[model samples]
Each structure stands twice: as C-alpha cells, then as structure tokens.
Target: MSLNSTPQSVRVHIGLFGKRNAGKSSVVNAITNQEASIVSNIAGTTTDPVLRPIEILPIGPCVLIDTAGLDDIGELGKLRINKSLDVLDKTDIALLIVDSTIGIEKEDLSLIKKFNDKKIPHILILNKIDKVSDKDILLSKSKKLVKCPIICISALNRIGIAELKQCIIDNIKEENTDFRLVSDFIDENDFIVLVIPIDKAAPKGRLILPQQQVIRDILDTGAMAIITKETTLKETLANLNSKPTLIITDSQAFEQVSKDTPIDIPLTSFSILFARQKGDLSELVKGAYSINNLKDGDKILIAEGCTHHRQKDDIGTYKIPKWLKERTKKDLIFEFTSGITFTEDVAKYSLIIHCGACMMNRAAMVSRIEKAKELNVPIVNYGILIAYLKGVLDRSLEPIKAKELLSVD
Candidate 1:
C-alpha cells in the first residue's frame, strides 16, 4: 500500500511455481519476510494464484506470484494447476521451487517444459535444504533443465535469503537503453498534439491508463504534449506558434484526428504505441490488410487486456464491433472477452482483435499473439483495426522497420 512497494511490484512479476507442499509458500514468505501465504501440510490449500507486491534488494519492485500446487488431485486439483499455468502468462522471472527431499518431480519437469516453451528465464530453488542431506544431488537434477541456477535455501531458517535475492537481481531484464518512446518518433522538445475525445465509451471522469502513460512518456522525453479533444484539435493547431511536431490520438478518433491535422506532420495513435510497446507492431501492421479479407457475417473476437466494467459505449464492445460491422458491410458475429481469457478455442473465429494492453507487460501480450498465430488465426488489435479502417495504418506504423511492414500488403 505504500509508495515504496510500487517500484518493485509494478514492473516485474516474479512467479513461484512447484508441486504441492514444495515450499512455494515458504519461499514467498521468506522473500517478502511476511507470512504472506498460509504454510500448511494440506495440499491444494492455495486454490488460486496469490499475488503479493513486494520489494526485494535484487529483483527490485515485482509481483510475487504463489501458484497453487501443480500436483493437486481431484476436480479441485485440476482447477489449481490450470490456475498455476494461467499465472505463467504474467511471469517475468520464474522461480521453480523444488523440495530437496522430493529431489525431482513430474510436475517440476512439466512446469520447466512450459517455461522453456514460452522462453521464460527461470532458476531452481532447492527449498527446505535443512531437511536434505545431499544438496548437490538435487542441484544436479536441476541443471538438466536449463543450466538453472540452483540455490540451497531453508525458508524455515531464513538461510540463503541474501543469495536468493542476488539470483533474482541477476535475472531481471532492465529496459533497453536504445529504446526511446517519444524521441524515436520525433526530435527532442517537439510539440505534439494529443487528441483525446471525451465520449460515453471513455472511462468516467478519468483518462485511461494508456493515454495517461503516453502523455507521461511524451513529457518524460522533454517533448510538449498539447492535449485536447477532437472537437478542439483543429483550433488548437491553428493557435500553435509552429506546426506541432506530430499528432497522436486514440484509435477510436484516428479518422477525425488525421483529417484535422495537416499533412506532413507525422500522425499516429496510442494504439500504435501499444502495438510497439506491449504487442507486436510489425505483425499487426501486416494483419491490418486481413481486415479487407473479412466478409459479411464472419466472426471476430474483440478481447480486452484487463477486465473492467464497460460504460454504455465501451470501445472494445460497442465502438469497435459497430465499426467493423459498418466497414465490412457485414453482419459480423462479434464476441467479447476481457482479461486473460483467450485460448486455443479462438480458432473458430474469422479474426481476433486485441486491446492496447496498457496494463500488461510486453512479454505476455506478445505471448498471446504468438498463441493466436499458432492456431493459424489472424489477430489484430483495436488500434490497428482503427488505423486500417481510417486508411492511416502505414503512417502510424512508420517507426517500425521497413522490412517488418513489407508483409503488410
């Protein structure tokens, strides 16, 4: 609840995964120095993934995810493992806690394979080391997984706490130095007009996270943000001392913004920034062409990154669906799912339209896109679709490498 918790918990998601009674809860408590999870002999007590935001010396600010035991039994146990696997989607660094007494497990191997498939970097924690006589043997088994850094720790005794923190710090991937959010798009100190139209779909009395983030990012780069509604966009530009550096607008109002902003100044949308920031921009740009492939009566899935109650005219549910139907001139069958509910079942639809995903880490958003690709389904986001419909997708996506957009046609 304190501001100090924000830095460590806001950026990274450290997921603790292992079989039942494998010291997952113990490790969580040890790292956080709190009895965050109930340590128990009873299996499957942690029904869902328990999320605790904590700051550690090594891992910085991150969310500690304690998953239900993967080895749970019965119908309830099945639900537990499913929940654990679902937690994998948000995991930035995975700590595979293995009980030294158990040595290795089928559940451990399966969890490792899943992490490997997702390219998630992980380490092995040989927990309850106080109970094991031969620590080397358990570590040897862990090395077979991915040259996993195996640490001997006694959560009961608080031994190796510093060592575990160091291991976590070693694995955290700091943001790349080469990446520039606003500077990459325009020169330094450039003034950019931001068109945020207030509508019924807009969150009541507050700007959405992506818009706020983009505004902050622009200011962070020393650029000026001239925020206004689409209605005032034309007049605001007229009053500026010079042509504003560029224009960024919501995908929902891209058409109006593009028309109001004169030609020559680069124009794009917040959704495009997300395509680059959180999701795969290149693939989505290419997928934009597929919108033309849609026929009347085809099905499309508009998925939101995080679940929240929608206003009367929610962008994903109301505006996008209606826009798609109008653009295609087809009675398109539209289905809506919010949060991390996407699955292999989406193969039945003609297309999948995702949100800007301001709330999700870049990795998880890309992973969802990869799964959609594996199913041979075309998945685009709300921004990309709006850009495509407005006929400015290329202009919006100009920052991406040319070769990446070569597949756009």
Candidate 2:
C-alpha cells in the first residue's frame, strides 16, 4: 500500500441494495462514471458483492459495494441473497434502488426495515425514472413506507446522480476526530518508543498496517517516535537522554519488552492500542477476565480480519491456542475463521478470540463485537489475551488508562 493512498479500512462504505434488475449496477456505473459492476437485464447476474474504491469530493475516500439482488430464488440464489444481506454489517451508508416501473415490493420494504433496524444512514432511490410516466407515484409510494429522503433518477441517462452523491455526503455522520491509536494519550514533543520485531512472519520490505498507522498518528500529534528491534531495546533505552513517555511493542515481544522497560514508564502493545481504536476497549478488557472461567472441552473461536499465508508458527492458529491451553490447563476446542467469514451463530462458542483487525474498518469490527455481546459471548483481541497470558495485562493497559476496566467481578 502506498503512503499517499487511502486505506480501505478508513473509507466510508456505501452499499447498493435492492431486488434483482433494479438498476443497482447501473446506479453504480452512473455515479462512478465507470463500468464498476456488470449491468445485466438478467436477474442474479451479480453472484457476489463487488467492491469499488473511489474518492468522492467533499466526502473524501469511500468504498461502493454493489451486492446481489435480495429477491433471488432457488438454493444457490438464497446463498447469494445472504451474502448481499451480510454486507449490511459493514455498510456505513446504504442506497436502496427501487425500479420505478415495478414500484415498491415486499423485498424492498424488508430491506428498508433492515436499514432502519441497523440504524444505518440510507437514501431511497427510484431508478429507471425515464420508463415511468408518473414519477410522483413512485416517490409517493416510497415516502409512505420509509422516513428517508427519496430521489428519482434515470441511471441510464445519468440523471439525479449528482444529487445522490450530495445526499450521500449529507448523510455521512462526521467521524470522531478525537479518536486515535496513541496520539490522544500523549502530547506534543513527547518521546514514544516503538519496538517492532522483524521476524520470519513479518511482511517483506514493509511494516504491518497497525504499525504504519500508529507511526502516522504519532507524527500527527507532533510527537517523536523512536523505532527499534526487541533485541536492541535495552541498549536503545540506555542511549536515550531522557525517559520516554511510553513504550509500544508488538504483542509477540510483550514479555521481553515489559521486562526490559522500567516500571515508571508506561508500556503497551500495538494490538491493544488497535483494540481500543477499532473496537470496544472496556468490553475486551472485561472479556480477558473470563479466561479464568474456561474449562475442559470449552469451544473457542479464533477469528482474524484478513486471510494470509500461514507460517509454521502462525499467531492465531498455533501460538494463541497453545498459550491458552497452558494458561488455563484445560483441553479446549478451537475453531478458526479468517477474512470476513465470522459466524452469526456465536452462541455455540464459549469465547471468541479475535485479531487486532488492522485490515478491517471500525464499523465492521464493532459489529462483530456487538453481535458477540448480544449473544452473551465473551470476545477478546489478540493483544489483550496475550498480555493476560504473559501476566502483564495490567501494566500493558496502564498506558491507555484501560486497567480500570479489569473490574469485571
């Protein structure tokens, strides 16, 4: 990834949803001025969700997701429909395209109900307006059903697309600028040490996403960041003229970094910082305590945000499970999921151990955490879980002021 290019995780996710052949693909092409999706007269042409990243002026970077029609049929069609619906979990803004010729159907209403139920900001669009003689009827019918802005557009002719873009910009709730990885916790001119290990599993010629983002945040706060390897961490600290404000390291080096650093200076890991930035810190802290309640044969789900080639000693599949068994001294069953494939039936799992989620947007990560909470399942991220297993969870959370959240009792 280029430093200038916007990361997909930070972009606004706008999803196009409705019944088949409702001009969803046409709307995508018209708005983007490119054949981003395949438009077809045949229903169910789009078998899966299509994602296109485009920079919309005023709205900044945004991702448009064109999904399969909801009104599909047959066994295979049902699977496609579920995939489209699943897009809602990460959808920041939704565009419901209704064919004006066909008017509103039960499926469209059901989609609207889901948009409302999820509290997702959305716009109701009546496409193929050129075919319909009476546009008022299309507008009136939808207005009665949904309490949202309704616009009529002819996607083929590129009409009303500018207005649609403006509506999307308007509906976008301003992000919390105050929220950051570590910048919010430190002040300008403060020295922050980042201990990154270049291991066999590390990506070639680049730092991972979480490390890159944290460095950027530190620079944004006008703070100084000193990068070093875990092997040279002790020497690097001794060389510093003054004590640094905080020391952040990769979770895999938590044991050594915590041991090498002085007790007065604060300490934490990159994954723990991301857990607070991407998901709920307090909930994850509480979930860490639940590790004590594990028993023999308890089923645990190990979930990752993105899929990658697994090394011999992968962190999620190999290291975490091993440490967990040793810590609890129990025979626990583990299931693994990677890259946007989290199971909805979360009740079956006794616990959910997730990755740092640097590859996923905050909305998607929060949705998973919320779903687990709704199912009464405990969810903890890789950093917090590893910190607890290392017997330094309290010290790891002290820098972020999250140690108080450990009072789950």
Candidate 3:
C-alpha cells in the first residue's frame, strides 16, 4: 500500500495501440499536446514503447504509453509487434487509432480482440477524418467492433481533442484523490518509524522517489513521522510511544530493521506497497514463494525499467545479483535487460525480478508481468525480492489486509 494506505502506483495509464502508419504517434502527440513519440511514414518508426506522464485538465495524473505498429513486417517487425501487444497487460484504458480513409483492417481488429480478452476499457479514434470524404461509413463500421465512445479527429489539425479528453475523464471507472499511505495503520498522532540506510547507493543528496513520496504521504496523514538509518532505529523507536503503529523500511535494510523492531507493531517494505501500486500485488506475493523452489544453475532475468548510467554499485546489476547468488548458492547464469529489451520469452528463465520502475508507466509494468505469467515463470520486483532475501518478507506485507490472501510459505 502507499504511505497513506493507497497503492503507490495509483496514476492512470492510457495506451495507444494500433497498426503502423495509422497516426498512433500523432494521436498521442495531439492528446498530450507535445511530441511524446516520433512520427514517420515508415512502417516501424516506433520500435520500443514510449511513455510520458502528464496532468490532463480535470482528468488528474495519467501516463500515456505509445507502442510499435502491430502490422510490422519481416522478422524484426514480428518482435516489435509482440512488444506492442505486451503493452496491453497493464493498460487501464486503450485508445485504438484507425485510419479513417482506409477503414478498419484485420490488424486493428486483432488488437481489439486482445483488448477485449484483457477486459481493458478502450476508446476508438477515427483518425485522418479530414482526409476522408465518407466519414459516416468509417464511424458506422467502427461502432460494430468497439462500443465505447468514438471520437473523429484529424490529429494533424487537433480536431476533437478536447472532446476526446473529456470522454476519457468520463470513462474513468475509478477515481482516487486522497491516495494516502500507511498512516491508516496508526492512530491520529501515532508514530510511523521509517528506516532508511544511508548507504553509498543512496542518491547523492536527495532521497529516492519512493522514500520521498512516503515521507510526503506520512505528513499528509497527520501522523508522527520519524526517519532514521538502521543504526538509529532502535533508539528512535525506544524514545517514541510504547507501540508505533507501523514501521516501513527499504527492502535492502529488511533484516536489520526486522531484528531491531518488535513483532507486535505492523511492518512492511516500500516494495510491497509498490507492487500493489505498479503491478498486481497478490500475484507477485504468490510468485515470491516460487523463489524457494529455485535451484542452482537456474536462469534468472533481473529487469530494470530505467536506462540511466550505473553508479559504482547499481541496485539492479550489482546488488540484487550478488544477493540472489549468495542466498540461492546456485551458479545461476543471470541476465540483465533494460527498458527497451523486455520480452515475453520467460520459458528459458527460472525467474524474473524487476525494479521499482519510477521511470516506466503502469501499462508497461503490467505487460511485463503478463508475459512472465504467459511463460509460466515466477516474477517479483526488487523490493519484494530484497525483503525475501533479507528474511523479512512476511513482516513487510503486514499492512495489507490481503497479506493473508497469499501465504509465501
């Protein structure tokens, strides 16, 4: 859960998926009023998925995801198409862009079927309406396949964009603003002890986004927030109330924090809340158990969404890999992939571990999770895996009412 009891990833994720040359990028640029993705007549200009976070007026915070063309040709095209379909896994809303002049084709219909199968809420955009003489015919044909609101627009001219956005706002099946953190686990003025280790890996001056977000959420809940490193946790807690409501710590410090904090107080890591925020928490909890069954020599893929240059000891590459190796004792041939390299071929790997993904949108995360499930591979995130390796994964999920929903044992 979030610092305020809401999931960490409560932002809405909207994806634009359709065949190439159908103005998918143009539509995204039009909706967002910025050059979010590159547009070209080329069949496969967009190879990897592109994501942009925006605050639409009256719609709140949302992430827009742009994917490759589904109708790409050749061997490389097939891979790109697979990746585009992968974006659908976590998409809360899908915008199907259709070339109004050419009308709906088989490729567009395939995406519609997939969206239906995923049960994702979607909208149909009849793009390039200005280039068509018979706009009526296009609208009539599209209504048969998708019953959602259809907006006719010339993305090049910015027509119907406001209406389209308003429709998106109206279609939101769920809306949450108060989005709180773990404060609900405590009393009005109860204490929430946050254990943060000032390791070399900690950012130069500022706290990481997750930690900062937690602090803000705690303050928002009118609770007493005490932050300290592992060395200061014991003394800090001892100086506080007889019982703090909840204690949250970075997964990397789980073992030390667990050893220091008494069991009566509820505890969990930043990752457990993130798992619920960015992906499916329950499914990941279930997947975490499969880690125990992992044997030596098992192939594992540790995935990171951001493509930034690594520091001396990067968490995704150096830290997690070393931790897994030490715990598993298996000569595991681990592989690492970046944002544009995620694929659904998990059959060859024993497990897949990902990061917090502040750089990636919710749709992309969902897509990766769905692919791992399709390959029948156990997938968990950095926070979850770190807590598990630290031997305190259980206490980390204490605030979740559904923590009992999945027993890792």
The candidate maximizing lDDT is 2
Model 2 clashes, total count: 0
TM-score of each: 0.90, 0.93, 0.81
Q: Which pairs clash in model 1?
A: 7-61, 8-61, 8-62, 9-61, 9-62
Q: Estimate, for each residue in 1-409, the C-alpha lDDT of model 2 and write its tens digit.
A: 3423768787788999999999999999999898878888998888899988887777677888999999999999999999999999888889999999888899988988998888788899999999988887777777888898888899999999999999988887665122378887789999999999999999999999889999999999999999999999999999999999999999999999999999998999999999887878889988888999999989999999999999979999999999999889999999999999999789999999999998887778888999999988999999999999998998988876643343344
lDDT of 1 by residue, 156-267 (tens): 8999988988988887666411123455666568898889988766777898777777777777788899999999988998899998877888888888887877778778
Per-residue lDDT over 100-212 for candidate 3, one digit per residue giving the tens place of the 0 to 100 score: 88888898877778877777778888899999888777788788866777999999899989888987887765522223445445556777888889987787888877787
Off by over 4 Å in 3: 1-11, 19-26, 33-53, 65-90, 130-137, 156-158, 172-188, 308-315, 318-326, 402-409
Worst 10-residue lDDT window for candidate 2 reads 400-409
What is the lDDT ranking, best to worst? 2, 1, 3
Better of 1 and 2 by lDDT: 2
Predicted structure 1, TM vs. truth: 0.90
Which is the leading candidate under TM-score? 2
